[model samples]
Target: MSSSSQEPQLPVIAVVGPTGSGKSDLGVNLALALNGEVINADALQFYRGMDIGTAKITVEERKGVPHHLLDTMDVTQEASVADFQKDCRAAILDIHSRGKRAILVGGSGLYVRAALDVLEFPGTDPKLRKQLEEECESKGLAPLRARLEELDPVSAARLGDARRVIRALEVHGLTGRPFSSFMPQREYFQPALQIGLEVDREQLRERLALRVHGMVDAGLREEVRGLDAIGLRRGKTASRALGYAQFLRVLDGGMSADAAVEETIVATRQFARRQLTWFRGDPRITWIDWQDPELVPKAVQAVNAASPASA
Candidate 1:
């Protein structure tokens, strides 16, 4: 470490929050003010044809801010957290090399965490994945959870939930080691400054509802139709995006558009709540009250505090 009092320069500035929390707008504004380039952290935004549903910022919307990591993946391709971390690191370094700040903007907390932290996951074993998939079809996730509990209680404890438990167990079955052991205790690699966006539950719900309706009006169904025509299936991650999943139900005649939109609003609100839960636990974050009257000034302060002294 340097003896000087100045802070170390870091590659990225991540602006993260839940959907419709004004993250995109704030990121764009901050980039304009700070001489930064935007790099998207949202998973769904990587799909090329997913526009209105993913709430992807267009060129006009980005206001020529030079956004990266958006529209970089094919809709059918699997884009994992590891892949995103590597890609984002490169993008951040590229921005820094260009003498510009890297602003990471999105609501995907897992993606943001993976990008900023040094994550370690178990080694991949395709045969094990296949076997686990077969077993999931045969017995269920419960049996896998039990196996994981027997093999590695520490990992099981950390991954108590169904989704994580299954994944952890699968990895253990493959690698013959606990998955949690792979998690890196990464030090703060960046002088990161986090800004959490906020809105009232009711207002957010209203916004989500309106946004879903607007997406439908903006040809979301047609977008899905196009993806389907291009062979993007329901099992793919892109197809499971909030609006896409709900609209797929609509397409299948399982639910009406109105009902789907209502369900989507509920789901999105729950997602926002979960995001808030995750972000609130991080002490490193300095929350900016976007709901407050002096949001701009507070945002500016956040930027200044986040910037390296040389900037």
Candidate 2:
């Protein structure tokens, strides 16, 4: 065999889309059809006992296909995309070495990109970060967000919270460049295929509402109650997760259970819109209708077409 033929064709597939878009089930189907194992890129799914809120696939749901990187962190631990990039890359490599396809699955846009793109994260300075945090505390996020908008309108427009706004400011303070400038370009670090799932906006809104109601019925409040015992509120990242955050308000008597569920549904719909915007900006993705019955087959075909041998 020629040297090119002798080299292994490692499969790196990423299934990405909005919440309630059937990404997890599609990923599992792809894995089963393509001899692949899953590496989670969902930031929320990394926390242990965060099952109900994050919609993490249960053991029975995974259907014997091995999954990596799920439930690996405590609720009190901060989840870092940089750290996830390292861990996910290692997991992908290990899966390839074992002669299996590697499936990267999640709705976390940056996390998925960090796994497959030639992206570099700037180093953090503790003192600077602390100063920025203090500033946010003493003054307000308004000043920081305004500054970010002036410096990097793109990032400012996308980031909605104070913590992330502060981090962007910290990046600018440290690097002397707009945080938007550090955004990943359209370059892949590995040979990979990205599949995106999309749904009609009205249908998606309805689906999200139903899903949130289902989660509440499935004991999401109880899940949060359990995590509260483990100091979930102390975790910078985990505490801010969509469903968890809303339910925490309910648990604190700041909101009613019914109100919490409604709020989570709205927040999730907005989040899904953001996710769709992020993924749609990337032209490399092969988008499929989420409700298509032939979704798995179409995804499999896309994967095969992406393989070098098929080229």
Give the RMSD in angstroms, all C-alphas superposed, for model 2: 3.2
Over 107-183, each residue of candidate 2 has an lDDT whose tens digit, in order, gives 99999999999999987989999998999899988999999999989999999999889889999999998888888
Q: What TM-score, computed on C-alpha atoms, does each candidate reach?
A: 0.89, 0.88
| lDDT scores of the candidates, listed in order | 0.79, 0.91
Which is the leading candidate under lDDT?
Answer: 2
> What are the runs in model 1 whose C-alpha is more than 4 Å off?
1-7, 135-143, 158-166, 173-176, 183-186
Q: In candidate 2, how many clashes are counted?
A: 0
TM-score, model 1 to reference: 0.89
Tell me each candidate's RMSD, in Å, in order: 3.2, 3.2
